[model samples]
Target: MPQHHTLYAAFADRIDAVLTALEHEGVLPPGTPRGNVSVEPPRDPAHGDLATNAAMVLAKPAATNPRALAGKIVGHLEKDPLIAGAEIAGPGFINLRLAPGNWTNELHAIAEMGADYGKSGMGEGRRVNIEYVSANPTGPMHMGHCRGAVVGDALASLLEYAGHEVVREYYVNDAGGQVDTLARSAHLRYREALGEDVGAIPEGYYPGDYLVPVGKAAAEEFGDRFQAAPEAEWLPIFRAFAVERMMDMIRADLKLLGIEHDVFSSEAALQAAGKPEAAEAWLRAHDLVYDGVLEAPKGKEPPEDWEPTQLPLFRSTRFGDDQDRPIRKSDGKWTYFGADLAYHMQKAEGADELIDIWGADHAGTVKRIKAAVAALSEGEGKAIPFDVKLVQMVQLLRDGEPAKMSKRSGNFVTIADMVEEVGKDVVRFSMLTRKPEAQMDFDFAKVVEESKDNPVFYVQYAHARISSILRKGAEEGFAPSADNLGLLGEDDMALVKRAAQFPREVEMAARTREPHRIAFYLADLAGDLHAFWNLGNADTQKRFIVAQDAALTGARLFLAARIGQVIRNGLALLGVEAVEEL
Candidate 1:
């Protein structure tokens, strides 16, 4: 699109010229620094169509009053023929109007580019790895993980569309106390499969029937081998089988929600790959390892040997961490951060950039993770941009009431439950409809409803409505034509102009790692399209399929037809469907 700059580009160029002249004429200092300048439609269109803050930002920096600088910038901009007028307004802002033909040409760009109208190459084909939904393999995913899954997948798609080499990954928690607990639960279920009475589950043990199959499979494979062994003897065998089966079920559950990862990095594999011990060796080599212990957790006293025990530690505080982190526990086993450090160390091998999608509960852990990455990279933090997206909690609703999680299970709604009810599209779209930082309401009744309030329905319906119009137009021997798209009038042009925003917004969302922006942009475009479609009812001549004038109607139909393509293209990026009807 940069090769083919539209009227929008020319307007920006005119502003650039105004800035350049201001600097040259000494109205502003000769070498004053400036941030990237942006020109877009003003919030209140009555002031002018487009506005920029070039004057406001540079005013004090150039040692001049902001309003005075805005006046000077406006004076230089008013000379451009494409700019109908330029005004200095509120807080030294410069507002400019186009010559009425600029927006018309944006419509032509949409018709010409079709589905590719808004694509960008801003990424320059850099490699980016987005690791999300690393939900523990202990059970099925729930509503809380959906946000990360959708956001991660959408970000990967958006990055690819913006010309980046993207990889979506999931980190499996196959090694840990949780997996050991899973093994014991499976062993209990094994007893159940043998027709033995396995009484109530003990505390800290998995009590769900979901583990029964895992236990039965273990018994079939190992037989009475573990029946006579100690806890250590059965723990390994049980954990191996449990993690594998748990991962399989987790994958199936994720598939049901329409998500798949390109990579599945396992914590256990790090140990198998000789990386956990290698991390200990690494900290030792860098002088980052030290032996020290003093205080226990707040409000708790340590054991008898708690006095200054020399254990290995990673000097993470040197890289801006609040405090140095321990790598080896008092028992010499690697701490969780030790394995995570090695995991991220392994991640640094193939992935140029890493993004972790963590839930709100682990919000405090982000600082240490980033500090660890920086320490491991030896202070080159920008190359390995370890971004941690904190997904807020989900409060499920049912029958217009606050839905409570199963107290017996000790958690909120499961992903399987949400998928079974709202389906993949609604679940995915609803997860992305709001800012990740803000609270979102997921209404069961409204998600399934066929109303404009439902974003997924509204966007899909816009595409379907366009399909109907094109089908009707095809019956009248009309099809889209890039040659005569100028025949599309003001209302139709509005739809195209909005469609043209997708490519850039898609790139922006990816660059910023906020997939919610794409979801919102699609809805904005869909709203414009729906408004334009409804306009046909009020203005008969503006109807897409006009039987009387084939050429004029063909131009309008062609313009509107591509709007559906844009919507579908945008929806596809978010992993949301673009239905042709209904």
Candidate 2:
């Protein structure tokens, strides 16, 4: 059996062929534009199993009215046994009802595919590098960083399932001033660890007590050897030591949310390798950078000493940025954008596409980075796709009130704290319930509540209920097998149609680079399952396991099993568990 049915794709292709035949018969123009043609499940099931606006889309170009063209298309489609009924709807739409055996056959096909059911070849194994949650190596990951982490991870999984070669990467900001602050903070903690009473943490440094352990670890390793050294001598040493420990803490915190990156690219390492300098030289040779002075801002107040000075700058304006961006500071250090450009340059060499997930605060940075990427890829003689998805802030709340800050993570709540409070599953699921760009409140009360209003619980309960039906079927000797699938009726067939949409949902989510759609799709699927199960409660004969009718019960069980399988498949892409019992 094929790994994916793609019934919609198959019918769409057949429709195109029919259109070509219609053209051959001289019924319409020879070459009609088929690009806008779409075959999708009807919004209202009463319309038909599937609907198409092909005639409406092509009618104007073909110089014919929609209903007339739809009639011709329906006439051709009705001749096929696969299409049981094809009728013209309002305007030019053609609604198609497939043979009942098609649904039963698809149910068997889905069961046969198992875990591989929804896997699509849409990505064609193209290399996609996804960089996300590159939080600074300064302290524990806070709640502010949670959304990007979950979104990135889920997007990576979604892409992988869609048949892309995906890389989950973290860009460590260890070369920046943040790590410098972390180093100094750890140095003070080191002093406190070595019998010296370090007073309250310095105002400019990290005040979180989480650094105490790092200071103790540094003292244990070096044994006060650098306690009396000058700041110059110990700053780099402590910076390197502290950055590593901070990353370890970050990784552990991410683990609490079930996130791990395949690569952790270090900004310091990129700088040390002279990658920024190399990128600068390349851009200069290509006339993409020059030593220039930038003008003062027009809309906003400029700095007090806003006089222009000669500095290396990238021609970001060439690719739609508001102004050319400076690549180097007055003190000759590469700016963050400079290093970021180098990093993206290196990524562009191997990756066919690059996706970055950043906090919404960095929204202004998107244009320049995209310009840099466009310039780099333009120089390469090929267009490399690059997108930056900004994840908005997540507000932590308890019982509709703002949650208390975590002392362990300083001023904000930690990812670990959230995970510990709810669970890895709840945290991940809640993060995706909304789009990454929209701010949301992660209410502690709403998430863990066992109610249909809670999407995570609702979806999970559907899977558990399906499992219950199957278990009861097994106990009553009505075990669901693909054998009696033809016995399924209108309700069973409707459920199968919903289940068949899994592959389409995966492809759609992957194409949009939005894993949240998977969550949305699963919720809808769960609702359908719940509604179907409720039907059984209204009529005992509709129950999954009938005490006397083993064959009918087995067919119903078959439908239930496929529903559960598709749910499990969707949840897998979202990195959520499909519980057998809630």
Candidate 3:
């Protein structure tokens, strides 16, 4: 169902074999509804190449003991050319160990596919919008935004690799009151850039020194242009200059982290037809526009005589939201929710699915946004398919000391700054080493430790070690060659089997919306490579780069080359760097 592929076909064949034998022997009653079986490697290597709990699942309906059923299934499987050994393990588990060289065939497949080794087309050409790092344009991105940025970017890459049409988007929060404050702040900097020292920041305005650059640019572009003008005349010009500078800074920040956006949708631009009129009209057409009254703030009080005011509200409660939401304020101004609604609606028009990467604070907002989209679709099949993921806060430390910051331009640490402090590969890989929802603590010392504690290094080492073998083999006159992989030993075959499962691992990551799965799988694959390497350290003849016997050395080097390719391909999917040498 998730796109026909060769490996899945092999799995399907194994399932069918079990089902047919069961039916033929009448252990399974006719029309027993045999489907949904799966084949995966055993948790322990001793169990087998692949393990299926098929017998235990089938035993109840077949009216037979699980072990008995497993025996019968194994009997049928042993005769299959691909199945070298089928053993009935504890509790009716049929552990299928593939034939010799069958596992090695995976190496050849990896070699054949090269960079495309684990790529899959599971999304079936569907369109998806991945909105990420929607950090307010008022400032640079902080370490807090890094996880979501990497996750969203890697997820977009994963989806695109799996045949989804993905739009990498940035929702520029340029229309809000925040920008007004930014304009005022830039005005002060405009004066400062003109040799005026406006010390200390005003309470509600931005305080980063980065804004000084914007003010400098403003003075350069508008020397005495708006000094004597009204707030209205200077606000827009300052606002535009400030936002453009902030965006340029943000873009540089993203590039430093190796993250880039395909589209930047400006919130202010969404108000082309005027936010108040456009949003109200859209809400009115759906009967969602209504009068709304303000409640005295729960903990804070409104001014006395702040009589209940009536205004337009979006009836978001109609579509799974917890409560009706206001879209307009008493002063005939749009609420933050108004521009947000329009922006998502813009996304709905082109995307078959909508995915947003947000921080945990916006968890409550997801339902309302989805509610708006559902209400807009009128509950049709065209209903927006949306999913919002929250990235938990990250704690940064250096050599056991808290990594402290002093307002590094913009309010917090930028993604660019973090990547600059630590390389992009570690930043990309480590962000995903933990589950997205789980709180992650990034340590400067541990990240560059060069031990197994550093996952990026471990994985990169596996690739480089493989390359080292190829270098030694080439020096020994071994022409790169691979043949009769079936002659490979059990340990050699196990590595090949893991290579074959890469696509399945990719699909699992995409389906679960868990990029961490790839991280976990690559780590395990690296472990396997390391295990094989250690075996060579213990047994000289098994060493991949043997100076004696060039033919066997070539064969072993080919296997090492295959591992290197897979590691490179896997890292590329996660947007992590793959270094061939340490």
Candidate 4:
């Protein structure tokens, strides 16, 4: 109903209006492309409240110099009552200063929206299938899977807030060699459960104690029916049972970190339904697949036994991969990539877009999978936007040294161990404080520290302080009131300006598919709130509550409440709680 509720969007519309007016007057040619024009907050606050490059972007098309074009645009901008001033900077950048009342109006909007303050509708309700944390069902979730899980789950929530119909999915890799090993591992434990005196875990099987429960459950169900049987007679039954138990364990581990997937598509089911065969036949029909021999593996010392072998290869090289990839192995089983291609095809059937959050270790496979999706899009005659986000590994530490592994997993630290040590909030927030592609350290000591250096603590502390101030105000016979918002001053507006960036940040992060941006923005917002609160210590009159001035206190209180609301909304997107107290 409103032109725009957020300050940045409203100003963007205003700038577009100025451009349209210039075109009508013939100063700028009609139909000049404005796609590159941008309206955003200046990098340096000293420049102005908002800055735009409309003139520079339009100058060449309009056959005019940027500065001359900028002057005309500023003339139209300055006529708007909401714009206090419009200045032409170096080149053709136009900087705009909004009237104080505009900031006051935004603060009111924040209050009116509450939890929905930064919510966006830019996604236009397009269905998005995001497959994340699809860890193999061979073992419990360890720290190795932690980063992708957090990044993917947070990105899912971020997209939902930006108004997309998001389907959170997990692709269960049960039809694989890894699950075969898990079956053997569970079989050994089952033997021990039936009092067979099973020796030390053999070299190639999982050794985690977590499998003991699965083995016990199996022994109870079948009562040693498959024990001492041939590998063929028992492998399938054991694999099915072990994978189911492992998935249940994975689900519980994810719940500890506040994550749940809407769909768990099984690779075994895909193969049973011959989806991979369908994909291969379709590819063959389109000449996207052929019988080819892959060159020997490339390396300083190629395997001496390596030889060219004919296989069914997908034309991944045509789509930017280094070489055509084999879809089936010499043993006649589908390769992981082949199964994955079919899985993505299945996902694309229900969604407008596809996204996968994978670990950096899987970076080598990115190009081929992207190529497969592109090929599928070509055959389908419709463009399906696809993205693969890689999250680097997180190094765990205790007090500055590498943390120890979990005894239960007997391999690496599990997500449950990390969440139990610190908290879900700390684990989720700390994982997000840095960009996912960059390496990060999750020191148990530093994450739980009560210092400003810890982002989660700092942001949560800001929310807690606001809660305390509001409670104290209530006890002192006062409450936040917008009746005297006009009494607010420049220092107050500065905080409001920082709070106002949430909506813009939301859209930018969603567009880039980077949920970590939300975490970075929240840290900066919290820092601003902290600095504003510290002002009270040096000057009592600057405090949120002025004992002698009720109206001013109410206005400041109102500002504080809205700022807290924004912090809560951001933390929710990150899957972290906003604690009311430290």
Listed per model in order, the count of residue pairs whose N, CA or C atoms clash below 3 Å is 4, 0, 1, 0
Regions more than 4 Å wrong, model 4:
1-4, 300-302
TM-score of each: 0.88, 0.97, 0.91, 0.98
lDDT tens digits, residue span 142-254, model 2 = 98898999999999999998889998999998898888888889999999999998877779999998999999999999998989899999999999999999999999998
Please provide the root mean square deviation of candidate 2 (C-alpha atoms, Å): 1.5
How far does residue 560 in candidate 2 sit from its true spot (Å)? 1.0
The candidate scoring highest on lDDT is 4
Q: Write the per-residue lDDT of candidate 4 for residues 456-545, one digit (tens) a residue.
A: 899999999999999999999999999999998888899999999999999999999999999999999999999989999999989999
What's the residue-level lDDT of 108 in candidate 1? 63
Per-model CA lDDT versus the true structure = 0.77, 0.89, 0.80, 0.92
For candidate 1, lDDT tens digit of each residue in 1-582? 443353445567777777878888988777676666677667775676678988888878778888988888877777877778888887888888666567656766666676566667767657888888999888767777888788878888888877788888899988788888888888888877777787888988987768878878877998777765788888888888888898898889889877888899888888788897876776677777777663465576767766766677777777776667788777877788888888987887776788888788887667777877766776334457689888887667765787776542456677787888778888988898888877777878888889998888888888888888888777768886656665767666566556656665775687788888888988888888788767779878878877787788867776776777778778888888887788
- What would you estimate as the lDDT of candidate 3? 0.80
Model 3, span 1-582: residue lDDT tens: 233264645766777766876788787887776674667778897887788888888788888899998888888888888877889888888887776656566777777788877777778769999999988888777888889999999999888877788999999888778899999999998988888777888888888887878888888999967765789889987888888988998888888777889999988888875644765676687688777764555566777877777767788778776567887677766677777887877788888888999998888888887777777655334877788898898888888788867466645556767787778998999999999889988998899888976788899899888887777776767766875454456677667777777888888888877888888889989999999888988897777766766666777778878888888878988898788688
Worst 10 residues of 3 by lDDT: 1-10
Task: Give the candidates in order of lDDT, highest first.
Answer: 4, 2, 3, 1
What stretches of model 1 exceed 4 Å from their correct place?
1-14, 17-32, 58-85, 99-101, 223-231, 284-287, 299-310, 316-322, 379-383, 404-412, 476-478, 481-484, 487-489, 546-551
